[model samples]
Target chain A: MELFFQFVSNTGFYLADYRNVIMIVVGSLFLYLGTAKHYEPLLLIPIGFGILVGNVPFFKGFGLGIYESNSVLHYLYFGVVTGLYPSIVFLGLGAMTDFSSLLARPVLMLLGAAAQMGIFFTLLGALALGFLPKEAGSIAIIGGADGPTSIFLTAKLAPHLIGPIAIAAYSYMALIPVIQPPIMRLLTTRKERLIRMPELREVSKKERVIFPAVGVLLCCFLAPASIPLLGMFFFGNFLKECGAADRLAQTARTAIIDTATILLGLTVGASTQGDVFLTGKSVCIFLLGAVAFSIATASGVIFAKIMNLVLKEKINPLLGAAGVSAVPGSAREVHLVGQSEDPENYLLMHAMACNSSGVIGSAICAGILWSFMVGL
Target chain B: MYGLQAITAHNGWAMAFAGALIVFSGLVVLSFIISQLHKVLLLFEKKPVDFQNDLERPDIEPPEDKLGLSLPKQFPADIREIARLYKPLVEALGETFCLSELYEILRKNDFPHPHITLTALRESEILIPDGDGVFTWNPPTENDDNEKVEG
Candidate 1:
């Protein structure tokens, strides 16, 4: 009886606290949202399960938690800590991306730039709210809406806040469909939504091949800190566009990205232990993330509306909503909202052009923030 | 350490405004560069400008190079079979999908030569473009219908 009681004392049931239960419930909600609502299941599922794994309550100093140096999860999380996984994920994104749309319509790239206003806006917000400059920068990237970029910047700027920042970034990215539509509707009229964009001209084989090379040079020269992330991103794109390395591109888009995403999601989720994640600061980060994401969406739409005043041929303002780095998610939402207003308005390609530029724009913003923090 | 004072003390106002400016500038420069890239490529692709020769032969026109006319001149002969294969698939996307969506569907289905088939469809006027990215598949021609009836 004594031995059995001792074993019971060592069990999670005995050690578990209210914070663990709260985090576990949050984890379950993420799982339900992913599986049932089908919101980024590839990401949310691993993260949801990882949250459950992390919150399972263990006694201290047993090398059990993700934060513990000697643990297996800590070893797996090294890729995240060193910013390797996000960079690898960017490589895969580059392989899969088709820049022809952006190439065909470069002015739409400005919508992407407009969207990045949210990142800086959020940085100011965080600073006013009493977050240290580094933490403010890390939290601000959640507005960029690119999960990998958020993780990369947070890992560098404020490694301690990775759990909340990563979770906030991915959560908002998944919730894009839910969050963006109302704001889009509030910001634009039916006429704006029904505005059909001009067609993208055919990008030539040579131009298609040259973009990645040019992208790396122009972006890296301007923001040298972005070299690590944008360097791998452009290299993967060059492999795909160069035509000489199709097999490598094939493996990169599939195997390399998939493996990296799995590790990143699981480790980021597991890093959110109850005591660490249930802080007042974590709640502030989530609130700031929401504000930042909304601002980005609004800025993109407003900029398009503003541009319409200057230009003869009008762009659908909804394309601006796709300016954040949520990729196909926000872009798809823009298309859906556009289609709802006018069935004939097919905005996917145009939205895709804006969407791709958002990736570059956000990365540049991340680079800028990182360098600013370092210099300051 | 909160509010406007905190922002100023930490140089928050300076960094935020500067950071935003840098981001906008970087993307603007990139967008400008990319906007001009195809034009530059067009220039290089032109027959060596030949400055002295151009001065002598001013009346000679440059090539008819333009965007949106990159479609191949050769239309593939097997339009009927290709049409048969894709008409149903295009219908699955209903009335208004863009060319990229069609390409994605074809690519997903492991259909052979997706890129070539798309270009051919455009060339042969089977997939009519709206001058925007939106496309519409023409209703079956009488020949295709007759061939289908016979088969």
Candidate 2:
């Protein structure tokens, strides 16, 4: 009878704290958003389930928690801690991405560079709000709207902030549809939104083949700190475009990326324990991340407007908001907005140019921040 | 002057400006390289022949009628089956057709494994290769068609 009473007392129902219950609810919300709403289900499903698994009450001394040294979850988390998964994810992204749009319209690439203003501006905001330089830099990359880059920079600059920064980055990425359209509407006139771009010039096969090599050289020469991420990225692109290693490219894009994503998402979610995640700082990080994303989207739109003043052909300013590197997600949102304005208008390829450029630009920004703050 | 030290020391405004400048400059350099490289590569490429216009050209001679052609005697069962299915469509497409056009036509008709179908037709001597990946349909002879009808 005494042993039965002890077992009942030690049950999760009795041992659960308010924070644990709150985290479980938060995890459930993520699951609902992923499954019902279909917001980045590939990432959210794994992460949401991981959060639920991590939050289950366990004894302190037993090595079951993700942070515990001997735990399986902790071993899986080594990739996040060491910044390996992000680089691998970049490789897979490169294999899948087509840079022809960016190459065809080189000037649109500038919009990508301009959109990175958010990262820099948000760094200032973070510093002003009293984060240390490294922490601020890590938080600032959330503005880039690239989840892997956020985790990579945070893992390097401030490992402790990885959980919040990654969550904030990914959450905002999933919310790109919700967050970007209003800003895109407020910033541009109806006519500006309706401006139809000329068909992009065809980029030759030779140019496509040469781009990754030249890109690697140019980017790495300027900022060697970006080598790990950009180098792998270009290498993957070379495998895809070189026309000789199609099987390698296919494997990199599909199997390798899928495996990395599952591990990265699950481990990142598991890292967010009730003790680590439920804090005033985490709340502030989320707020700052939202502002950063907004600033990046607005800056891209505004910069595209500014570019129209100089160019002969007026660009649809809506394509500019795709410059935040949420990848095809932000680009798709740009297309939807443009379609709403003009049914015949197809801004997908144009927005994709900006989106692809945004990926490169943000990676460069990360390298610059890493070089200056973390000394490469 | 705000520089690397300022960024290292957590000078938010300085880092912001510097970071923006660096990102812009690096991408601009990359943009310049891509633009110039494309232009340089274009100099070496021969002007691409417009295949659609070539197909429409009146000067090219029509392929000789191949109505008497028969499937190879040693053709595999799979190849023969595929050839049988594709023969009517090949005849409907007329004498000469682009491989891609035929693939699309087969796809529109919901034909399974168009590539395999095309390969099988080729192996059965029903599709004779013309220049530039185009093919000429070589229909079975009247005797073979009549044999099939009677048998």
- At residue A33, what lDDT does model 2 achieve? 91
Expressed as tens digits, the lDDT of each residue in B35-134 for candidate 2 is 7877677565534435555666668677644334344554334444566667776777778988898887776655654555577677767789998988
Question: A112-156 in candidate 2: lDDT tens per residue?
Answer: 998899998888778777778898899999999999999998988
Off by over 4 Å in 2: B1-9, B45-151
Residue A361 lDDT (model 2): 88
Model number 2 iRMSD: 8.3
| Model 1 RMSD in angstroms | 8.2
TM-score per prediction, in order, is: 0.83, 0.80
* TM-score of structure candidate 2: 0.80
